[model samples]
Target chain A: MHPRLTLALTLIEAVAILAYAISGFIEARKRRLDAVGTFLVGFATAFGGGTVRDVLLEHRPFYWVEHQTYVIVLFVASLFAPFVLRTLSRLFSERALLVADAIGLGLFSISGTSIALEAGMPAFTATLMGVATGVFGGLIRDVLCNVVPLILRDSRPYATCAFAGCWLYLLLDHFDVDSVYSLIIATAFILIARLVTFKLNVRLPH
Target chain B: MHPRLTLALTLIEAVAILAYAISGFIEARKRRLDAVGTFLVGFATAFGGGTVRDVLLEHRPFYWVEHQTYVIVLFVASLFAPFVLRTLSRLFSERALLVADAIGLGLFSISGTSIALEAGMPAFTATLMGVATGVFGGLIRDVLCNVVPLILRDSRPYATCAFAGCWLYLLLDHFDVDSVYSLIIATAFILIARLVTFKLNVRLPH
Candidate 1:
């Protein structure tokens, strides 16, 4: 909770939100949704997971509500969704977007798990909370887009990676490791594992 | 609230939950999901709307969490889903199900609007909250079933009915009417309107 670490986490969260929003924008456009629908889908993709986590933990003043700046940014971005989408695609490859999303998944999962544990949830429940935080945004986006959630259908081990990462964070915390290092290590573990699995086409067995 | 009125509202809510859960059961069975998946979907349908309302209003210990019996009932129902489905179909026609669902929509919408108003939200936001609570359970069900939400795709006057009903309740409350009477009037208005519109094939023009 040092000032520098807190600042770093906030920056990473912003990036993650942006990454998730881009996917929402793409899907909304594909569905030919209007500006309002586009903005809503984008907002949900960016904030849905955290919102769900806060709700389950009975936390108040939702992350988006507290960080009104994020809502404003998304609103403005949504106004010129086409232009924003073009600019992002031009600046970053699909691979880069995937990497950013993976980092976001890692950070969100660990944070959610940590918060649940602090709320006195058992380890199993906390780990599930972490996974929910990591994946619920995309799940909601797909629902809005009228498709099966990719996480539910895809065999790329997305939630599994989050599950592992959450357990790692919990273990480190249990051993009284410095939280800053534990957070970074667990996040990196998820990020690397996600990318590696996606590349190798590793899948969960049906 | 009078004890009798409180009991009436609770009973209405239970019926609403059961109706919503039935829809989930049908969808999950159609998808051929396992017992666990069926239970999860049923639980979501039964509670998704109220849960979303609670989250938005920052209400704690979610309705389902507070009413553990609901969870137990849904779990047991899920275990005998096939049998329940058969029994239900035999006992009630499709039209009967629609009637029950419409009544549920009315009750949930009015209650949600009333709750939001109690929490100090503006009229417009409270109305939206009501519509959300009325329709979200089915929305989640359709999403989990990998289809566009019926509310989004159907031209039927589903959410519109909820919207108008919420306004009616709000107006009555603003006029200082007794809540018990207002609740009954608004819920009946929605129920009758929904059934009539469905019968007449009312469609919102795109």
Candidate 2:
């Protein structure tokens, strides 16, 4: 991956982590869980996907080693969880969750695919890793909450967007396209596809 | 390992897989998810940890391969999920979930440790595999559900029991004890300890 692309991914990752952490905090506080619940959910919601990606790729010490930003983001998110949750009733909705998660899915798919290519994984494997990284965290968080996974559910386009964007990235890479161009194309595809599907109730075939 | 112990594990595993699959079905139904949702979560609830363990341990085909019984069990559980759930609900509660999960923890820890040893992994690495085998399934399920992981949380004893059992098994194996005795001792130790912890609401100190 190009240096500029790498930098772009780092920034997007930072934002995605922060966004998901906030979502987790809001969820925990709504349950009236104590501090531990907030932090635990926040941590999982933030790092779960990336951690799974890293471990599967056999990356040592994990991604948390390079950046403490995710941890800090979760901490900061947890601190304001109570206050934010109060206003969440106005600002948060199913539509909002879809948007935030879609943004996250785009960032994670790009980053995971980029890392897999850097690690010399095959294009198909890279795409699979990208989709896994983008979606598995929320899946884990949902399962623990005793809810149906968003990705596995019939009514959601979560994994479908990730899968589409991942394939786009890999196909672009195979053509030796510029990293930034590939990323922009893939991210836009994911975000637009996700938003449209959510709004229209489009779902994958059974 | 003795045939008796193997038989015992197989029986427990069959029940556990069916039980977990049923839980997944209940959640999927609550969301009004389609057949895909029911099957996917059922698989995750049953095979998530084992898949993670096999992938991590570099074992191919996975445990669900030889014993297709697990698949049959998951299918049956899904088909009759509504009836099974009504019956299960009368018996299932927070306490029941914990107990069933604890049984899975012990069985997974013991069997995973034994497999690691058979593969000639180092003792510590074997222990790690044991823990991974025991926790990864629930971790996957929780991620799918988009909630905080119980293993990661301070909620009761989970991974620690596996760790202790791993070490105990290692010690017995190192002393050249019969593998049968070692497995029995380790599994019993973990199951009893986990049950006690759940009963007493014992938890790890932060």
The CAPRI classification for model 2 reads as incorrect
Query: In model 1, what lDDT does residue A190 have?
Result: 97
- lDDT per residue for candidate 1 within A86-137, as digits (tens), equals 9988999999999999998998899889888888776766886787888889
- Estimate how well candidate 2 is docked, as a DockQ score: 0.20
State every prediction's TM-score relative to the real structure.
Answer: 0.60, 0.58
**DockQ of predictions, in order shown:** 0.14, 0.20
Cα error of candidate 1 at position B32, Å = 3.5
- Encode model 2's per-residue lDDT on A1-206: one tens digit a residue: 77987788677667677677776776677667777778888788777888887776676677776777668766765777777666765777767666766788897888788997787666655776787788777666665556665567655677668878988888897899988888888987898898988788876433
- Best-matching candidate per lDDT: 1
Q: Give the 10-residue window scoring lowest on summed lDDT in candidate 2 chain B.
A: B60-69
- TM-score of predicted chain B versus true chain B for each candidate: 0.95, 0.85
The Cα error of candidate 1 at residue A133, in Å, is: 4.4
Once superposed on the true structure, which residue ranges of model 2 sit more than 4 Å away at CA?
A1-11, A85-98, A120-125, B1-50, B54-115, B118-206
